[model samples]
Target: MAPWLIAAILTQGALALGLLWYLGTIRIPMVMRGEVRIDDIALERKGWPKREWQASNAFDNQFQLPVLFYVGAGLALYFGPTSLEVALAWLFVVTRYAHAFVHITDNHVIRRFAAYFAGLLLLCLFWLDLAVRLVLSL
Candidate 1:
């Protein structure tokens, strides 16, 4: 795996952590208080939807997939990475962050689809890489 790939992973991982930190410390309470903030950073001005403890569950749904992807990517770097694999691994993180942003802040069509498809593609690539490597080694 390339060093730049590691850097990409680290950058996305940091952003994900930042998102979690903000959510736990900020969004959770706001949700508990039935608050939704305007998403001015987004192309649209609509606020996040009303959420309760369901917000926490939503966080879990959002966070869980990427964490697994991160672990898989880390192992690939530690073991080996085809250039294509590294690229896809990096894409996974970028899309995960985008997905999270779409999921939590701005629920728009393009952003939501970009997040979902990117993640699904990466996950497929991750599994394919692992499967082929295992088969070839055998």
Candidate 2:
């Protein structure tokens, strides 16, 4: 596997750790304080403390956009990208970390969107790179 793919996996692991950290530190307190019941932990509900809620939402965001990232990394590893592609992959991971930070902190929409869009652009670059390689090879 490519080093970039390993970094991408680690990025996903970091996001999962964020979710776990929130569940243990934030959600557990809400449950203890009676702000949220154990039953209320159901995904169908949205009754968490503000920061905890944001953490949960940010965690959910991981599953959404990062799926594309995982796919891109897998394809990149398989296709063998240039060094620039590897750097872009790392940039995408860093942008996700930034997005999560903004989301779980001030909940700043514009900052989060900036990070999100930057990552989106990186993902598009990955796809474009793959397409160009495929075209040149054929």
Candidate 3:
């Protein structure tokens, strides 16, 4: 993989790590203080505070569309990534960060959706670029 592509992937990984840290910071204390129950949370995350829930949901979101990002990245690495692919990768990372911000902070559905959609579009473009490259090479 190119250094730039690795950097983009690392940045996305950092975002996920940061969200995990944030969730733990919020949730561990709540459990310690009896603010929430482990059993309750274990069963579909019931009784979690709104803030914790949002953070958790944002963390969970990382595994969804970003899975595609990882797969696309692997393909890009194998096929040799173009500058456009690198740019799209970085842009998708930015959009995911934006989506997480809106989801955990204000919890605004429209804003979150816009960010998510933007990331999705970027991911699609990245895959499309890879597909075209592969077809052309063949």
Candidate 4:
């Protein structure tokens, strides 16, 4: 509802679009062509189709999940700032980056699962927050 909140949501949307672009231009292409190892520049230095590249795709996917969340949360905020929705929005951003980190460095099951859980939790929160807003408004 507030202009600042809308701006924040817009930024979040842009971030999501950036992730989508990364997926389309980079991930999908590399996956399709079987060109691994990040970029050909990396390949020039080393080789191709490395696990890191795959991990990067996964990382981006993880980050993308939050985009939907912020959009939802932002809409909810237009109604009012319930801690629930704001908290969920924050969680969405955190989990996304955490997922990216785990994919990049840790690459552990626990970390991955936490990231997944966080994302799913945020997704659930979006609807719950929205529902509350609707019910309360009515």
Output the number of the TM-score-best candidate: 3
Models sorted by TM-score, best on top? 3, 2, 1, 4
User: Candidate 4's C-alpha lDDT?
Assistant: 0.63
- lDDT scores in order: 0.67, 0.80, 0.94, 0.63
Cα lDDT, model 4, residue 17? 64
Model 3, 1-138: lDDT tens per residue? 389998999999999999999999999999999988888888687689789889999999999999999999999999888899999999999999999999889999999999999999999999999889989999
lDDT of 4 at 133: 72
Measured on C-alpha atoms, candidate 1 has an lDDT of 0.67
> Could you tell me every candidate's TM-score relative to the true structure?
0.66, 0.87, 0.96, 0.59
Residue-by-residue lDDT tens digits, candidate 1, 23-68: 6776557545657543431464245434423333335655677666
How accurate locally is residue 134 in candidate 3, as Cα lDDT from 0 to 100?
89
> What is the C-alpha lDDT profile of model 2 across 1-138, one tens digit per residue?
487567766877688686778757987777778988867667655666677778887888888778887887777778875787788788888888999889888989999999999999988988788888889989
Off by over 4 Å in 2: 39-43
Candidate 1 Cα deviation (angstroms), residue 63: 3.4
Error of 3 at 86 (Å): 0.3
Best by lDDT: 3
> What are the candidates' C-alpha RMSDs?
7.6, 2.0, 1.1, 6.6
- Name the candidate, 2 or 3, with the larger lDDT value: 3
Global lDDT of model 3: 0.94
What range of 10 consecutive residues in model 3 has the weakest lDDT sum?
37-46
True lDDT of residue 101, candidate 4:
60
